[model samples]
Target: MYSSIYTESKEMYDELKEWRRELHKTPELGLELPQTVSFVKNKLTELGIPFETKVNGNCIVGYLGSGERCLLLRADMDGLPMFEESQLSYASQNGNMHACGHDIHTTALLGAAKLLKKHEQDLKGKIKLLFQPGEETFEGARAVIKEGILENPKVDAAFAVHVASTLPVKTIAYGTLTATSVFGFKITITGKGTHGAMPQNGIDPINVGVTIYQALQELIARECAPSKEVSLTIGQFNSGTMNNVIPETAVLQGTLRTFDSETKQYLITRIKEIVKNISKAFRAESKIEVLTDIPVLCCDEKRNEEIVKALNLMNAELKIISGLHTTGSDDFAVYANEVPASYFMIGAKENSNTIYAHHNPKVCFNEQVLPIAAAVYACTALDWK
Candidate 1:
């Protein structure tokens, strides 16, 4: 049955590629993916797979088969907030790009929907096809959970696969603690505004912001152990509008990523401490607002072994690799928290040249992994007990 799925997906490769390219052209951003959602719903309807919209019509949940034992297969369809630099014929022109290969995730899951529905009667229980939105903003999974994507049939376990543009085609990578937890925050520094020529007139928040940024960087290098994976990055910084006049407020937004809970808490505490004390020292007031707080994604060891064994027996030459870790984070941790779960990365490296990591404007993934991931998704569901 597993080998048969591989053959079926291979035969649908062209359709999968067409779907991927169609999605690649108009990569929607954040939670408000109307067009993308409609496209998916239409496709699901065409496949005769029933679905319902949640998260204010953003999150999509499609179903196949029946029984109390349900397995959820999830895929995110959001695009990054960047313009595409790749000169492909179907490159995104809407100023948003799917540089993270989420387009492939959605397409592969769609392919899986077709495959699973084709073999719906063969499923041991139920299959919940989770078409998640706003994964880039880290809101999709939580939204779906709040709207009860985990309930209804009540999922027993969940599985998701992300495409890795850097890994060679057909390579499947999986392991524990695959993604780091993230604490996204925005810091605002308020100070007195004054003319540029008056040195003693006002406090400069930009100056304070620069100092705080430098200190936060040192917090990672000096405070955290070298063996620990801790990354504190300031992705956005904004201040005054005029060059000559000092602005009243300066804002700094960044994210803290770590694999250790204790370390994450400690660093978060230290970040607040640093922001508070440093701004005060500069005679400025500061405030910290959390934008997103997601837990680390750790796959179940026993579940991982089971899935690996099944996938391997399904396709011996599948090139499955284990013991891999990534600094990048995903909201899939929300699902992993609720049930026994496992995740894997399918390789999509297209060439031997220099590789472009995810979120880059120039990044493009190999489409060959499209059907392979689709088959993997279908096989996982069909074989799950």
Candidate 2:
């Protein structure tokens, strides 16, 4: 039965495709995933996979096998807070969309749960299924870790797969330094409220915010080395309401990402110093709030070799590409930092030139990669030493 993992996963294609489309329709966001959790719970129950809700109710943990060595297979179950423009019949009408292909991630893990459960007795070790919530906000994994989501069984290794819309279908890419660390922040600038016409009476916080934003951007180009992989992006800026009244405060939110820890620390210190000194020069009060701090997703090289070999042995026809890395961040970084772990990207793009990247409203993934991902998840676990 274990030898037929790839074939069986392919046989379940229609069922897995339905699961992905249904999940794509009713996407949830943040730590609160009510309907999404309910659907996962029901499916897990039907498959006779026992699981317990932990942390935020929907961040569930399902069990398989009972040996000393355990492998954690994680799937994030949250979506982005954006409207879908993809005119597919099952496109999400709700304000939220699974533009990141997390729907495919969750469904592939479920398909793995089904396959692993069918051959539980032949397994040499344990496989822990983590149906995590709040990945987009970077809160779910931290909360779960606090409550000991990794303690009860103490996993030896972990694995995760993300769907990529730009790569050809059925291609699997692996690498050592898979993703960059991220530090998300919000800066608040406070200025006195006054009539807009009386510009002399009030300090302009918007001006201070604009200056700080510019300084932050320049840090990457001027302060950092050209060879270092670093980036800064300010996504949101909110200030005044009325045209005649000067607002009391302005807020700017942004994220900084890099692969080097020393570089990350240097930038954070510079950011704080820049904000403090810039606000003082502008005669405005300011405060900086830390929103998220995640480490770089550094895949274990030896483990990567083992998993890559296991995957090829599982399906000889499967394409295994190497040396792919990105600056984008994932909270799976938290898990990889804790244990010997590896991550893979399975290609999910349709055969078309217009491939929209992740988080795009019009993004679509090839459903054919669903079973391939499921097979990879299950076979990787079953074949692990």
Candidate 3:
């Protein structure tokens, strides 16, 4: 009943692609998406749809129809803080880029919005469109929820889509449970500076830093459970400015990911202990700070089944994947924690070896799947009873 809604509007697919391309050309970052927000608001107005803006900074919410079985569909609107490297005519300007395919996600939601508005009479319940910002920093979803976007209408089911490059085109894959907990840690060690010739005059911060890193490695490799997948990576390390002189302090920054809350907590505790012990052995003072903490994302099995059924009816390829959690994390888990939710991936890769991963300046997606994504999103909402 839903797939037929777009039969005569095939041209809208091209129009949507152009819109996506335009968004890609002028990318905005985090909660500061004025241009993007204005564009979405303008589109809703053009279609005669009603919407509310700035529930949370750049986030925009729109409502269609009136029913008790409320469904929430979300799309991220912010771009990365990196510069664009792709040579496409629609490449990002102003040094902001959609390295994570949020442009496509936003466009697909818009396409779905158009179709849903046209078929508003056939809908059984209310549908809330969440155009969220600051996803790159993992703050938008929580902000929007805190602003009462979910409480006012009280969503029964929520769905979100991410464009994936690993899966083939026209194929949709979703993990029943995805990694939800992610944390960033900053370890700073302070020691006494010394001249190169004096071995005992002062403590060397770099040496202490290295020892702490090795200790952390052992903690993860030997202490953590073998079955649990966890990552402890030190992405940045800085100390000393001169070759002959020791620096007083060294900094270590990295991220940690886990699927379980207990394991996540254990990891954090172990990291602190390791750093403390290492610093004591070197007679240095150390501090460990947690920058961010996100819970794990678990898809509602019932909602997932409904989504699969809808996709099947639309003649779309579907695959159920397990243990496919990436090191990356999303604040979308914040909403999933409170309500039944499903986050699906849309294939964006065109070639096996040529596609780049997310957060890279060169990352790009296959625009041809925009319509397919929009169709799936619309169909899922249509079937959500």
How do these models rank on lDDT, best leading?
1, 2, 3
List candidate 1 segments past 4 Å from native. Answer: none
For model 3 the TM-score comes to 0.92
Model 2 scores worst on lDDT over the 10 consecutive residues at 1-10
Per-residue CA lDDT of candidate 1, range 1-385, in tens? Answer: 8888888999999999999999999999899999899989999999998899998898899999988799999999999878899888999999999999999999999999999988999999999999999889998898899888888889999999999988998799999888999899999999999998894799999999999999999999899998898999999999988879988999999999989999999999999999999999999999999999999998988878887887886788889888878889999998998898899999999785768989888888999999899998998898888
List runs of model 2 lying over 4 Å from the truth: 1-3
Residue 158 shift from truth in candidate 3, angstroms: 0.8
lDDT of 3 at 275: 90
lDDT by residue for model 2 (188-244), tens: 999888999997999989989999999998988899997788999999999999998
TM-score of each: 0.99, 0.98, 0.92
lDDT of each: 0.92, 0.91, 0.82
Q: Give the poorly placed runs of model 3, Cα more than 4 Å off.
A: 6-10, 193-200, 240-245, 316-325, 351-353
Which scores greater on lDDT, model 1 or model 2?
A: 1
